[model samples]
Target: MDTIVYAIPVFMVMIVIEIVTTIIRKKDYYRLNDAINSLSAGMMSITSGIILKIVEVTIYTGIFSAVALMEFDSSELWVWLFAFVIYDFFYYWTHRMGHEVNILWAAHAVHHQSEEYNLTTALRQTSSRFILGWLFYIPMAIIGIPPLVFFTVGLINLLYQFWVHTRHIPKLGWYEHYFVTPSNHRVHHAKNRKYLDKNYGGVFIIWDRMFGTFQEEDEQYESIRYGTLKPLRSWNPVWANLHLYSDMWKDAKATKSWKEKLTLWFRKTGYRPADVAAPMKMPDIHGYQNYDPALSTSQQLYAGVQFFILLLGTTALMAVYHTTPTWFDALWIIVLGANLVMNGSILEKPEQAIKLECLRFSITASALAVTATLMPVASIFWLGLGSLAVLSLAYLRRYSSATEPTAAIES
Candidate 1:
């Protein structure tokens, strides 16, 4: 939470800097605001995962603290430094596995969704890392690093990675061969087949070098195509996760055999469409691709204003709910993770998903209110907000899906 608090101000400064630089260069691209909004969806997904991890770890500690009893009672900086390195090692492997495994890719895919690369792209992180990421840190627990120290270092490592997302910074001199820099990270985000799974380092590129997964940003031979092999046409956060899943599901269902259906989920994306047709040609997707800035001034301005307001409101909401949970807080997390998915579901040409997500959000919000009242968090605050959530959801559901959308709502 402290890390989240600190990042708020940092995000503000970088956003401003990104804008001024873009405008000064007169480089045409989509509004930086749209890119930032996309970042929010990315962060929301990450936040939800964070809350879930807190809940799980609290449970893990509560249950295992006794069995895994420790003798140490206080501070030790050296131990923490050692722990940080160990944690990074764990992160390297987990990050690598995320790319290799299909299930893990679903969660990591959020970061790669942005068609453009910029400072905002750095903020585009996954919403589902907490689902399985904590398992990687169990070694720290086994080694007896206190939970407080573990959490602090994890936050520090995350904060460290955010700045490396920008293209504004060139290679970090000789340090380029040592730590993870913006140039190295650019390669990590690239989808060029050669750069696909390289540069899997957290703080130090040494790990990648030692592990043989390191790839330099080759200007001539190996270029970069940002974003995923598949594109997310809409802006809805909720749909981001489910869109691919839904596509896979539809294709799987259409398969002739049960075995084929079962394997489809594990196969590479776009697999089950099997004897896949010829590849459709696409644009460069990086260094001035996708939404052209020269052509989209109005949309960018609108999205920028909309996001500023939404984030302000969200920060206020977090403050209001500060007293709710001592164990785990999922309020903002849900908003960030599900917002896009819900928005996307609603926007599909068919309209069934939009209706379904509204219903789901309504049910979940109301149930949460009831659960809060019945549990330790029985504040009058949640009850009222939950009621508001229910009503707001109902009203949103009133929109007619029969008509073509005037604007894109889902990401």
Candidate 2:
């Protein structure tokens, strides 16, 4: 059974509850563009996992078969508990280094790009984290923890983290002393000097306290600023994943010293060569504001509608990926990813967003036509394509005007 899959409904319910609770308390912690962008990054992460997970499984299985020192049975409860604790120990180092090291942060920074701290922000995962994340769990394979046990425990740890991302949850008294609570995890996400690089534990706060990375929530000081040191201003999910890596590449190219160019990836997190000048002024955290772009009511509604449709399609793809044909699965992922890229563009209100949306729908229409012709059931696919075509035409007619004012929505 897929543990993450089973937890999806629970996560959705908790998110709805958080939204309602925040509304009741009159705290506006969410923006439409920010929430949608966060969720889009999450959906893209899952889609990318469909392929990248094979590499992880292959590497771990190969290493275990070749070099495992002991056989740990998954059927034993004690063995499962041991594996759980050990996995989190390694996860701590992986996560901590992700902040301190330059190359690893390139992939892990996507999760910290959101300025709003909400339930949706928990899902803002990095699609490129698979590049190095699998390496952190190899100790389990080396000690002969069964792959099934490792997978299940890791899923449980991740599900435990979902509840701690919200601002609605306060300090949980003694529970905060033992486990990772919303208070400490909130400190983990903050960019302030006091809170920076603290709370690296995944399942237990004990690790952070033991390792000296712990910091209690200081309410008297500055309010938490949720984002990276450098703001990712745009809403593009693909760019969100690649921006830091691209920055590293640009810095490396601009440097005069060959040794500096090669060592930059392995250096400390914010290191820059003397020869290469800083690009811009450091962001002012005290007077910082969330990146909320102006969009017309029509554009906002259009993005919301399309985002809902694409999210449904993504959920279906994830649920049945095992049984789905390879080509159809690839096509579905590509279309959904393209849909999100254009959605981000629309939210950012760029001049080319409308054109991108039109092109995306045009390609989707063609894909549906091909799917209808090839698949045994054609009516459903044709009906979907027709509805999409009509929606695209209406959107172009309504919002493609040059004189349309950039109106913004608060929610």
What tens-digit string does per-residue lDDT give for candidate 2 at 1-411?
Answer: 244566667777887898888889999887778989999999998887887778888888888888999989888999989988988899899999999899899989999999999989999999987788898888889989888888888878887888899998889899989898899999999999889899999889899999999999998988888899888988899999999999889999999999999999988888888789654455678776667878767777777777876776677667767765777767777877888988898788645666786688787777777666544433444555566667867877755665256643332
Clashing pairs in 2: none
Models 1 onward score TM values of: 0.73, 0.93
Best by lDDT: 2
Output the lDDT of residue 330, model 1.
Answer: 62
The sequence of per-residue lDDT tens digits that candidate 1 reaches over residues 1-411 is 334755776786986787688778785333453475466675575456544566657744654475454633338778788868887888898888777766567777887788767777767776666666666666667657777777777778877887887766777689999899989998998887778778988898889999999998876765466777666655667666566657666766776777867775665543554443443344444533442222133323333443454455345434444555533356544543444344333333223434554565565455456446534444433544455455544543543423232333222
TM-score of model number 1? 0.73
Where does candidate 2 have its weakest 10-residue lDDT segment?
374-383
Candidate 2, after superposition: displacement of residue 205 in Å?
Answer: 0.7
Residue-pair clashes per prediction, in order, are 19, 0
